[model samples]
Target: MTARIDLTLDCANASLLAAFWKTALGYADEPPPPPFATREEWLASFGPPEDGSEDDGAWLCDPDGAGPRLSVLRVPEPKTAKNRLHIDIRVPGHGTPAERWHRIRAEAERLVVAGGTVLAESDGHHIVMADPEDNEFRIAANPAA
Candidate 1:
């Protein structure tokens, strides 16, 4: 059997990032593990942190169960450099180059309204964008037709 993987993102505000990602990726808030009706209840089992800080994090899962789970955790330090790895949101469609680019730009605009900032564009290829926390990601037009 193949192993499943989950992606974790460190941020200053987990809830805010989670909300943006949920909109970007069409993911839903992950349900608490079995035997716990609510996330608060499950977290309570772990007790408070050693430093007495609140456990600030959010978990998200693809509604279709096809994508890796995402975990956004709150951290003390701010992001100072570019991310070596980033997510690519693909816009796949069967159309001419112009049509494909339109689709890509449309998605990028939607993301902009969802708290993303467009950094660069490659015309008919892809667009680089940054999330609310400045994590870089891409919106690409799929070459497959």
Candidate 2:
């Protein structure tokens, strides 16, 4: 059987990161499971955390159900270093090299408006960016596509 995977990120603010990621990946807030009217209600079903601390997190999923779900969980510590693993937001299309780079820059600009910061740009390649919580990710156009 094929294994399914979900990506989880540790951040200081779950809601903010989730919002940024939603905009970045064209994902949406995952609704509570069936029979539950609200996320709070669904969470309540699991009872309180064993340690008595509140469970704080945001869940997101690809609207088309092709990508892995993302979970942003609140953590006490801050992000202190570069991410060993990061997400690559692929801009979809085919065009001349200049046109492709333009598309990448356009998407990067949109993400900046959505609370992402562009760290660096590789000409006609990719743009390195950071989400609101400083999680590093890249925006690029697939050369093969």
Candidate 3:
């Protein structure tokens, strides 16, 4: 038997991280559970915290329903260490080394615009990047893909 899986991210702001991920991955925000007409209706049952942040948790899904579900969980503490596990964004590029680097850099730039920062890069290989919450991930070239 096989088990299904979802990606979970612990961060300070679930909503903000979810938004950034959705834009970066071309995902869509998950709707409220069944019987709730809207997200607001679901939230009203418990009410927002004193700070007035509406989101306590958030979920993002691939628009085509092909990728794993992303669950953003809000936590009080900030990320103090590098991620033990990180995501690698692969961009298909079957060309020269320069072309591959270009593709990777382009993707990294797009992610930067979506709240990610370029940390470092390996020539003709991968670009290490960090999300808004400083979660480390990589953008790499998949030439054989």
Candidate 4:
């Protein structure tokens, strides 16, 4: 018998990190649809409101569409230093290095707008980015320099 496995990340903003990874790795955001409290006055079947005090707002997804799902846990403390485990993304290059850079650049721009920092990357390699909580990751298609 084989055992299944999954990955989980404790992050500052689960939703934000999910979105960033969704784009960076082509993963679908499978966030559980919002659940609201079903008021007696209303005839809707809403479950309940999320516990504001718990670490419940987490993000999850299956990036490769083959591997087990990964989750990001929302927390109060900001991320410090580098992650013990990190994800490296690779996309099939269609044309020039400049073209690839452009695609990566666009992603960097969006991530930056969403509170990510562009650290650094080698030419034709990839760019280093940190999430809102400063969790660093590399986005690149090249496997070697």
Candidate 5:
């Protein structure tokens, strides 16, 4: 059987990164565990971190229930090196290469408004972007095979 998988990102500000990712991927926040009634109640049970560290991160899930779950964690340090692995957002497109690029540009603009910055782009292929905290990701065409 295939093992279930999830994605986790460690960042200086989990909440910000999570928000950016949630918007970029069109995912929804993962609901609280059963019997909790609300996220506040669930979080209250932890009694806060001992050092008073910020804990505003969240777990996000694909609303369609097909993509892997994403968990954001707050870390004490800043990112100093490029990510060894990163997410590539596949946006559906059709028609000529210019048309595909137009779609990508539109999505990239929307993401920029939602807290992502375009780092670079390669014509109709892909656009590299960074989340609020500087973690890199990409937007690319999802052409049918």
Candidate 6:
């Protein structure tokens, strides 16, 4: 038997971030952040970028309700130290390295505009970026070649 596992993110707000991860990983949604009236109604409405989803918390959920979940919690303080752990993403390994890089590059770019930041880059195929709340994640170029 195996134990279920999920990663906890002690950040600033849960509902706000849960939406971003929902799109990035194509995962399902979780309950809306705390303290909102009529949670379901609030969840149905998506806010603009300028707002930064600041009112709600965030989550990097597991779609099937399996696999590791990335839960973002709202904290009173900021992240002042480095993350002790992180997640790495590699697309299906089937194509040229360059193709993988390009595909990954586009995803990374979209994430950046959506409030993610690139922390490091290695050629076109390798790049590191942080989520809206500074959670570090990687998106590698095509692995389908």
TM-scores of the candidates are: 0.92, 0.90, 0.84, 0.63, 0.87, 0.70
Best by TM-score: 1
* Candidate 6 C-alpha lDDT tens digits along 12-63: 7576567667767777745556565554446556654464444545545666
Q: What is the lDDT of candidate 6?
A: 0.70
Candidate 4 per-residue C-alpha lDDT over 112-144 given as tens digits, one digit per residue, 9 for 90 to 100 = 876778888776668887776677777776534
Report lDDT per candidate: 0.91, 0.90, 0.85, 0.65, 0.86, 0.70
In model 6, where do residues sit more than 4 Å from their true spots?
A: 31-60, 141-145
lDDT of 5: 0.86
**Steric collisions counted per model:** 0, 0, 0, 0, 0, 23
In model 1, which regions exceed 4 Å deviation?
A: 50-55, 143-145
Q: Give a tens-digit lDDT track for model 5, residues 1-145.
A: 9999999999878788888888888899999888887776787788986664436567899999999999998877878999999999988857788888888899999999998899999987999998898889988899682
lDDT of 6 at 32: 56
Q: Which runs in model 2 stand beyond 4 Å of their true positions?
A: 49-55
Question: What is the Cα-based lDDT of residue 111 in candidate 3?
Answer: 90
Report the C-alpha lDDT of model 2 over 17-112, residue by residue, as the tens digit.
998999889899899999998887887889957653334788899999999999999888988999999999999889898999999999999999
Candidate 4 clash pair list:
none
**Which one wins on lDDT?**
1
10-111 per-residue lDDT for model 1 (tens digits): 999887899999999999999999999998888888996766333489999999999999999898899999999999998888888899899999999999
Model 3, which residues run further than 4 Å from truth?
40-53
Q: Which residue pairs clash in candidate 2?
A: none
Residue 80, candidate 1: C-alpha displacement in angstroms: 1.1
What's the TM for model 3?
Answer: 0.84
Q: Give the Å shift of residue 78 in candidate 2.
A: 1.0
